[model samples]
Target: MSKSRIIGVILALLGVVLFSAKAVMVKLAYQYDVDAVSLLLLRMLFALPLYLVIAFVKRPKDPEVMKPKVYLWIIGLGVVGYYLASLFDFLGLQYIKASLERIILFVYPTIVLFISRIFFKKLITGSQVLAIGLTYVGVVLAFSLEFSLEGEGLFVGAGLIFLSAITYASYIAGSGWLIPKVGATVFTSYAMIVSCICVLVHYSLVGDFNLMNYGMEVYGLGFAMAVLSTVIPSYLVSYSIKMIGAPSFAVVASFGPISTILLASYFLGETMHWAQWVGTVLVLVGVFFVTKKD
Candidate 1:
């Protein structure tokens, strides 16, 4: 591999690891009695300023103006992708282990494929169908294991995370067209800014605005989550995709569930069953084929 490809691989792996850590961090914050809304609020609040700066600095300089419809698309996708997806993930983590959550969420590629098929009339080959089967079978395997282990809140948490995956996949499906119209950096920054605003608005309506009430540890976790998981990894993944292309980046990103499982084990003391390991492997394999270029 070329030096650029090597660097892209490193960045992709690092970004996946950091992004996986978000679940662990959120789980940690819950120990402080912080609600999902408050924790999500703190995360977006901390990260919002950076996104604003990036949106301004990276605004497209082309003479052509974007249509109002495009702006609406960005806003809608931003809310669905980051705001709602993240809220569901945070709430789900309160019930499920991070390992199981990551495993479930890792199937978004399959969701993306189905979304494209249903909405855009994209054809799914036989292998793609098989890949989908494997992915869901693995998820069911893992979900059953988790449900048995943690009886309370299992269904609700799994349902919420599945919704998170679907909404995120919708964002991915929508953003592909828009990202080229606006540059990747500009599109991502703007989408994130919109997401931050929505999160803030949601918090203001339902959550206490007084963030200072939380202990310092909660703030620290929030800041770490925002900067390390959200901002840095966002840029790293973008740049990695630029360097190595999206196909390679998606393959590299298959390590995400493994990273989360390891992190959850080390940091959160969550143990995985042997069968769950099998499920994780199946998910990784299925998603790999699902995202593999034809």
Candidate 2:
């Protein structure tokens, strides 16, 4: 690989690792008795100013004014992609282990594949079929393990995270086309700002701002999540995609679940059985194939 490509892969990996930590951080913050919406609000609240700064700094010089429809697309994506997806993820973490959540979220690549096929008329290749099969099987293995151990909330949590994967996959699919129109930096920053606004709006309507009066550890984790996991990784992945293209970046991102599992085990004391490990391997292998270039 060329130096740029090598650097792109490294950045992509770093982005995946950082993004993977988000679930772990969420799990940690839950120990403080913070509700999901409040936790999410805190994350966006801390992260909002940074995204605003990025949007201002990266504003187009001779501004390429897009159609109003394009702006709508950006806003719509911001809502479904980050705001809704993040809300579901935070809520789901309340009931699920971080490891299981990551594996469930890892299926987003396959979701992207199906979205393209259904909406964009893209053909599903044989390799993609096999990849989809393998990935779902892996998720089933992991899901079954979790189900056996937990009570009724198992499915509820899994379902919420599964919804999160769908929304995030939609973002991935839409952003692939949208990013080229708006510069990656501009798109990432503005879209994130939109999501931040949406999160704040949601918080104001239903969330108790008073609840934010938590211990130092809660605030610390929230800041770490916003800066370390959210802001930094979001920009890194955007730039990495620009450097290497989405398909290659997707391949690099297959490491997400493994990193999450390891981090969860170390930090959260979450344990995975052998079946879960095998399932994780299968999901990674499947994602590798799903992301393979034709």
Candidate 3:
């Protein structure tokens, strides 16, 4: 690969590493007794202004792209990508094992491939096909090791996570059309701000939002999740999408489970089975194919 391509690949992988740490951090934050709603709200509270700042400064001085259709699409993207997708993920995490949930959500890349093809008529390459195939095999192996069907709730949670993955993948696949018009920095800022507002409105009506109820650890974890997981990684991936395109970027996302597994083992007192190791390797192989430069 050329140096520029190599650099793009490396930066994308770095984003994935940061992305992987998110679940670990979220689990750690929950240790402080914050409910998912409260924690998500807090993360959005902090993220809102940060995104607004980016949007304010980055927007150009020239004639702006201000058609109602564009704004409407942005709103739709925020609702599907940020609010609804995240809501499903957080809820799924409550009922399902983290590992199982991660496996389900990681299917986003495959979903992205199909969604992109249908909506944009983007053709999938041979490597992309192979990468997706390997990813599913890896997902099966990963689940075999950590499968949990503990309750009726597990099935519900799995469905939620699957929906979350599909919605998220659609957002990622479709956002490419918008990113060029708005640019990654500006597009991400608007998406986040809109997403934050949606979550805030939801939480205000349904969530407790009690300041005194949550301890410092909970609040602190919430902020950490906001900065590290949501804000930072989302921005990084936005930039990655701009730099490398969504199809390639989604390939790197194939490895999201690795982050959860390592984190679970370290902090949650969880153990990985032998099949998990095989799964992780298979996932890496898929990631390799997905990310391979043309």
| Clash totals in order | 0, 0, 0
Give the alpha carbon lDDT tens digit for every residue of 209-244 in model 1. 677898999999999999999998977876676677
Error of 1 at 169 (Å): 1.0
Q: Write the per-residue lDDT of candidate 3 for residues 1-294, one digit (tens) a residue.
A: 677656666667767767667666667776777777777788888778888888899975555675678788888898889888888887777776666667668777677667867886878898889888997798678666444545577677778888998889878866878888877877788888889999988888998757568777877767777887788888888887777777677666656677777777777776767886787677667756765643
Q: Each model's TM-score?
A: 0.94, 0.97, 0.87
Task: List lDDT for all candidates, in order.
Answer: 0.87, 0.90, 0.76
Candidate whose lDDT is highest: 2
Tens digits of lDDT, candidate 2, 1-294: 899999989999999999999999999989988899988888998999999988898887754556688789889999999999999999889889999999999899889988998999989998889988998999998889776678899889999999999999999888888887887888888889999999989988997777548999899999999999999998888888888887788899998998999999999999999998999999999998998953
Best by TM-score: 2
The TM-score, computed over Cα atoms with residue i paired to residue i, of candidate 2 is 0.97
Check candidate 2 and list the clashing pairs: none
Ranking by TM-score: 2, 1, 3
> Which pairs, if any, clash in model 3?
none
RMSD of each: 1.7, 1.2, 2.7
